[model samples]
Target: MLKEILVHCGHSFCKQCIQKALGAQQQSKTPYSCPMCKLQLGPILELQKNFQLCSIVEAFLASTSKGQQQPGRLSRGRRAEKGVWG
Candidate 1:
């Protein structure tokens, strides 16, 4: 039996046992347990990075800055009325 591990789900099992369990699940409605260790496999931890999400935030800021070129217009004439020297 080949030992296999799924990093995303944090579960390790024998390859043959996993295959047989999958087959049984597909073939009929039956509860299957890990044959080697009998550990109830639950959801695995999904490793997610925030780099892509941060990039999206940065892109939104860039676009907003482009649209804010006319600053006084956005401020509703408040800066102009107050005689603010830009």
Candidate 2:
């Protein structure tokens, strides 16, 4: 059976392929290029998706949108201490 993971390019790659690419990246200083397209994968961390099996398009959007949010951002202050600003 072929175990697969989602690629940043909205494509499916076998788990073996992903591991191989990551190993190549770790062994060498250069980024690992995609086997099929030869596109450099910046970071293996960038390749891992927040959602498993999610389409790359959706995953990319989600990653860009809220990945940088501060933890407890809105809950930092009590309702009585601050009024609604936005």
Candidate 3:
């Protein structure tokens, strides 16, 4: 799912993607920046998880999966093709 990480520039990204970017920056000894705006966001360690967005995501998933056999459980291997967050 869209695990939220709040960038200093007020942009949000999926936590996985942010972590990957941050890891890349660490290897390159560069500053972290918002992927969308390219605005410098300082250290990745300074960022905080956006709980509001996270709750929204959780709610959406819960609502969407209600009719399924296993509520809130996404089918494996079906997500990648749909680009859905699990």
Which prediction has the highest TM-score against the true structure? 3
TM-score-best of 1 and 3: 3
List candidate 2 segments past 4 Å from native: 48-86
Q: Which candidate has the highest lDDT of all?
A: 3
Best-to-worst ranking by TM-score = 3, 2, 1
Candidate 3 lDDT over 1-85, as tens digits, reads: 5678888878887888888988898899888777788888766467679988899989878865885446555666567767887
Per-candidate RMSD vs. true structure? 18.5, 13.3, 6.2
Instruction: Extract clashing residue pairs from model 3.
Output: 1-86
Query: Against the hidden reference, what TM-scores do the models get?
Result: 0.29, 0.42, 0.67
Q: On residues 20-57, what C-alpha lDDT tens digit does candidate 2 reach at each position?
A: 87788779877766666767666554555424654555
Runs of candidate 3 with Cα error greater than 4 angstroms are 68-86
TM-score of 1: 0.29
Deviation in Å, model 2, residue 32 alpha carbon: 3.1
